[model samples]
Target: MEHSPVRKLLTEAGQRQVEARIKAAEAGTSGEIVVMVVEESSRYRHASVVGALFSSMIVAVAVGHFQGGDGMWHFLGVFVPLFIVFHELLVRFAPLRRLFARKGDMADAVGKASLAAFYAKGINGTEAATGVLIYISLFEHMVRVVADKGINEKVDPDAWPELVGGIVQGIRSGEAAAALSEAIDRCGELLSRHFPIREGDRNELSNQIRY
Candidate 1:
């Protein structure tokens, strides 16, 4: 089957890691599943960060207008450039890269679980768990996106911290999928209840991620 160039690239990247993990699994190496999930999650999370940062900046600007603060513009002028510079440094510097690497590991774990669910047979439990995780990570990213649009007041501040804690616990307990799914469901519920987006619009925004 023919695939889009972007899809082809993603498949190639995923295949490399999947192949390595399969080999490790066959060799009786434990943690192969976890490793695969982590790798994918990291890639997704990094992309999400870029999205979140830009979104946050836009929101900050809008909020500045309401508050009538020239300070906001000044902060934006200084920090936006600094942020861009820091992001470039992160791409180039090993230490900075490693430091922020784990920030998105939660997203990666759930993403891998979702993939595993699609490919692995008779392992519905893993698949289900991963599916939940993927949804949750997406939801978290959604919240960040919404926040960037100046909708922070719509979100409960406690939600993010709780979700992060759950992700960490899930990783520690080797139940990453379950933890991720729970977080996603909670976030989704909150979003639906407090900040409902039209299905068509939400899907439109989500589809952009594929590219």
Candidate 2:
């Protein structure tokens, strides 16, 4: 239930557009490109505890000020209920929960999730080792570009940051689909340059966007 944050990040039309973009991107290159989106990279349950604790402390301080007492008992009482309430709130609301999560933790989680997605979706299964994964973690507002060994050998890893930044900017502007379309086109250019489609190249991956 915690994972089910309103799957409204992309509409049906947006998904189709992204899927089409993936197809077009792969057409010019032997590389297989896959786009995967997730509501979140991780549950980040610790964030809920941290949020609850912070909220409870604030409320307890106010309560103590009003009651004019040592406030240990008052603090405890307020903390117990507030912790429960805030914990649920943070878990259900990603924007609020994000405030409590460390940037390092979010980055690590997204990095690992993208790698998992690359393997899970069989993006690594291409014959020429030219598969590339464009992974998006919505809750963390992160984008990771994972390229297979074949492509990595020819293309510098540094080439991906600009592409990732474009997607991140798009996410911030609420135009993720369009941003991704442009990024995929750029990816196609890069891939085709390094790994142009061979006469016998076959489509090794599905063009559909993965959830």
Give the candidate number with the greatest lDDT: 2
lDDT for each residue of candidate 1 in 1-211, tens digit (9 for 90 to 100): 1343223223444434433433332232111112112223234347435644654476667766676768746658655765576666655654445544554564455545555533442222331121111222322221111122222455566666666677566656655445544554554555455444333331211111121
lDDT of 2 by residue, 27-107 (tens): 899999888778899999998898889988898788878887574686788778888888999999999999999999999
| lDDT (Cα, 0-100) at 145 in candidate 2 | 95
User: Worst lDDT window (10 residues) for model 2?
Assistant: 1-10
Q: Which residue pairs does candidate 2 place in steric collision? A: none
* Each model's Cα RMSD: 17.5, 2.5
What TM-scores do the predictions have? 0.31, 0.92
User: Against the unseen true structure, what C-alpha lDDT does each candidate score?
Assistant: 0.40, 0.87
lDDT of 1 at 190: 50
Looking at model 1, the pairs that clash are 41-108, 132-181, 136-184
Off by over 4 Å in 2: 1-7
lDDT for residue 39 in candidate 2, whole number 0-100: 87
Model 2 residue 37 distance off true place after TM-score fit, in angstroms: 0.5
